[model samples]
Target: MSLPRYQEYKNSGVAWLGNIPRHWEAVFLKRVIKAIDSGVSVNSIDTPAEENELGVLKTSCVYRGEFDPSENKAVIPEEHDRLACPVRAGTVIVSRMNTPELVGAAGVVRQNIDNLFLPDRLWQVHFKDAVPAYVHYWCQTPIYRAQVQSACAGTSSSMQNLSQDEFRRFVLALPPIREQSAIATFLDRETAKIDGLIAQQEKLIALLAEKRQATISHAITKGLNPAAPMKDSGVAWLGEVPAHWRVGKIQNFAKRESGHTPSRQHPEWWENCTIPWFTLADVWQLRTDNVKFVYETKELVSELGLANSSARLLPAGTVMLSRTASVGYSAIMGCDMATTQDFINWVCKPELTSDFLLYVLRGMRTEFDRLMMGSTHQTIYMPDVAKLMMGLPPIEEQAFIVSFLDTEITRLDALTAEATRGIALLKERRSALISAAVTGKIDVRLS
Candidate 1:
């Protein structure tokens, strides 16, 4: 929908704030903000505090016009006294220190959070005349973000700081209180509608993923034949399989192999890097690219490195499953490659196909969740992994299952990609609407 423009406009002198409504003033934030209060840095646990306990807000608590109270850490009892500047209603919390992109992110609190306190990385804005919601909306605009990017100071690329003085000096294209309320109200309704649509797309994506996994799980375990007789597979998780299929330890069909990292202290071992090395860093590529076979990797090791280390150069078509840190993701090696110990490699014998083993690993998400252990770093230990059992289908059936899944997954992926694109367009619209309304590019009073 097209929005009506202000009848009259005047130059605001600021590059980002090119022009404003005739009556609106382009004023420094200090003129409208009473004070920017900061909370003390407190020793806190990683877990969120219970309702009865005091918590310190993490820098992540605020994002582009969004507030997440749950992104807080429980304050240690000894540091409870350090909890100052309790989260208050009608205040906008701005990130004073964070990664470059998120340094000046702001979110307005809708209600009083009595037990939650801000951290040093965030500043609580006390408005003197500005409406908190309107200011919060303004903060999300491209105009405000450009100023934030210019004002941020730090030597490091990863982290930047927005000082209270720099923030106070930033200009706002101020509107009358009533007009500010109107813009905020208009945004509240419009953005919520966009967000709701985005949510539906997200739900669709999730449902599609679940269906995809279920399809694979059923195909691998039950085979494509619906009328096939079934038998108990003895393993509790492998409930039942086709009557003709064999159920036994995966090691019986494939030779289980381990990988190792060459000593980093010996630079000579890492020299002349040539072999593709599969590590946790490359796992993200597999998931994001959604490729069944992994040919490329983030890092490569030298032949010198491999010869000295326990790492072995496995043949093409060998299956690799990440066993530590990032667990359960499996893929077939597209070429001869060595891997880091983070993976559990398998060289399939004549009886089992690498593709079939990969499917079994992918479809066993439930079983993976059950076997995984450790608090900080989850791992499927060697002993349990060695004894892992899977249904063994005939070679022809395995090939058919792989081919069927490839086609069905491709169809589902296309639908998911379309839904993802819808969400992205909705977000772009929401952002554009906010920028237009807040910067006086469009009048939202009657919108």
Candidate 2:
């Protein structure tokens, strides 16, 4: 679908839609709309207790081009005489103090509730010739948002705001009132359909993730033998383990060890280190395919006291468990790297397969957290790690289970990625639709 081209004029370095119908005109926001400061103050007074007056709209109440009344904060008292930002049902509200990305978040007020107060952080827009809903959708477009962001100023923590006067100076292309209403109605139906489709894709993605996890957990705990007798594994999470499987400490197959960081004061040690040093942040995602930095061999051996330690390069199949901050997260090592003290490396023995052990450890993370020590900083001590009992199968069975899970999970991941991409495309299309309709690229006037 190609958009119709029209003559354009630049305002504050932004192009405005021109060559519009003779009746249409490009006007400054101040000229077409009035920004009123409804001084119904909430910070100075106490909140009311009545259920009817229990809701007050804050900046967060408006999000993603809609007003979420459920997110409203406090209610206004009946005695409050000050007219809280009085906006009609169709008025547009834009957030003034949000981050640059969210600075100009705009939504139309679809319904009117009595005594609803708009916090000072939000700016209410009342359009003259154009429908408020149409303008609201226009402001949500990427082009307009970039303009708003460029006009804003402030530090990173708190974004600078646009005063009513500055907001009035904003230039906008205005179609006839009937055209504006027609465009808004068209967008309301089209965007709602797109949103519904995106939501369905999101649910499918979640279902795929859950199914993948269940498949991995089942294969690791139970052998491939369909007729194997099941026995209670004592732990509620490990309900029925294969009767032939043995439960023993992880230390039986692998050893527990901590990592050390070379002194930062001596930059030389870190400068030449070729060994990959991983911190807690590095373990945030499930896959660590791309490591950011590497450490020198000399620094790894001398400054880091890893000479005898050798940074535990347990082949490509090692399973790693995170033990701090974001605890209980586990992933199979895609490559060999040295992890910080915040991890308990599970080096699988010759009797165990790496992929099989990875799945088992991933399933056992919750149990590991329950056994973790330290009140101030949650940690899984080596002793606690040594006490964990796991059910293991023979080496050949482990390989079979790993191969089955690998094939199944790979399919699930592909489906999940496709659904995610579809959702993203829908969102982009919705934005483009809104931008085109409001900018007069599409004719909304009915014959």
Candidate 3:
């Protein structure tokens, strides 16, 4: 997939665009025949506008050099007068104010939009001489991103502002009109092939995850021997279980404990921290790293902090379930630790093991979704958690199930990791292809 370089080249005097085809021209953005117009901010609802209604664009409308008209909100009738910058074809929409990484993102529209208006954080560039698609692709290159990063302004690092003057000063290496169209067409075709491969890998990853969850649910609900006699478990989610398995409330087999945070106002309580503290911050380890046991925590609490607060130093092997904010994630504690109020801890009795309980919790994702409450922040209240039930297998069977699941999960995780790596490589190739084509690093006229 390599293309031939141009016959002759010359330095453009710009660091990003080191060398260009002899016939190509490199010029500041303002030199092109165009006028940049910005839009005014308006009050709008979160819902997108209907075909007959007017809408105001959101900062998310442009991503990765692509335009999404649907990423806009419905504008009420009163704010229609403030909507001056109407979305039009043959123009580029650039985000003028956003987070540092996305401040100068731009996209080109392929068709004339009727009722969509830009917001104050966006600017519309109407090109008179340059090809809109070429300019859009150029905006995605690292060259444009570096320049935008250097020229960005704002008091805070999270949100950056890009001025029209600074944006216009961006320089691009341009080819003739026919060559520009050819390059854009070449990218559209080649990138589509790469995108299709990436999509297949993503779908494979999703299917592997579903299979992993199903495997866990099946092993925990039914015994390894399919011929084992079955009986009604009484619970709707736990339809039936092995005849010999014991069925009862979850609280009967384990002691349910809640977590608490130390008072921030007491400065002395926070000093000289030693004990490991499990809080919502450490849930990311379970969510992404796919680890079954939590050995370390992001923060630690002092003995004074534990004494002053309602927190308790639970022993190793305690099962921790995040009950609020980020709910449903569970793991076994690898060492003695205290926790914040965000988790629901459990100490299994002699009849149940912590590893077995961890599997049961993971298998009950549907039940978690059903019992969770609240609009903005969902939580599994103590009362609902107390009423939960499970089918208890024999100790030997519980140990066997844990061992079988550990093996299966390891295989699935390896497959998922491979697919994820494939996606990363595809994205890198896409970015490199776009950068090389837009900057004349590789001649794409005949690609």
Candidate 2, run of 10 with poorest lDDT: 289-298
Question: What would the per-residue lDDT of candidate 3 be over residues 74-191, giving only the tens digit for each residue?
Answer: 9989988778888999899999888998899999999989899989899989886788998888888889998899898544699988888898888999898889999989988988
Off by over 4 Å in 2: 1-19, 36-59, 72-88, 113-120, 153-160, 260-271, 287-302, 305-317, 364-388, 445-447
Candidate 2 local lDDT, residue 241: 86
Whole-model lDDT, model 1: 0.89
- What C-alpha lDDT, on a 0 to 100 scale, does residue 175 get in candidate 1? 94
Instruction: Candidate 1: give its CA RMSD in angstroms.
Output: 1.6
Estimate the Cα RMSD of every predicted model relative to the unseen true structure. Answer: 1.6, 5.3, 1.6
**TM-score of decoy 3:** 0.96
- Greater lDDT among 1 and 3 belongs to 1
lDDT against the true structure, per candidate, is 0.89, 0.67, 0.89
RMSD of 3: 1.6
lDDT accuracy of residue 228 in candidate 2: 93
lDDT of 2 at 387: 72
Score every model by TM-score.
Answer: 0.96, 0.80, 0.96
Tens digit of per-residue lDDT, candidate 1, span 197-273? 99999999999999989988898889999899999999887888999998999999999999999999999987888
The best-first sequence of candidates by TM-score reads 3, 1, 2
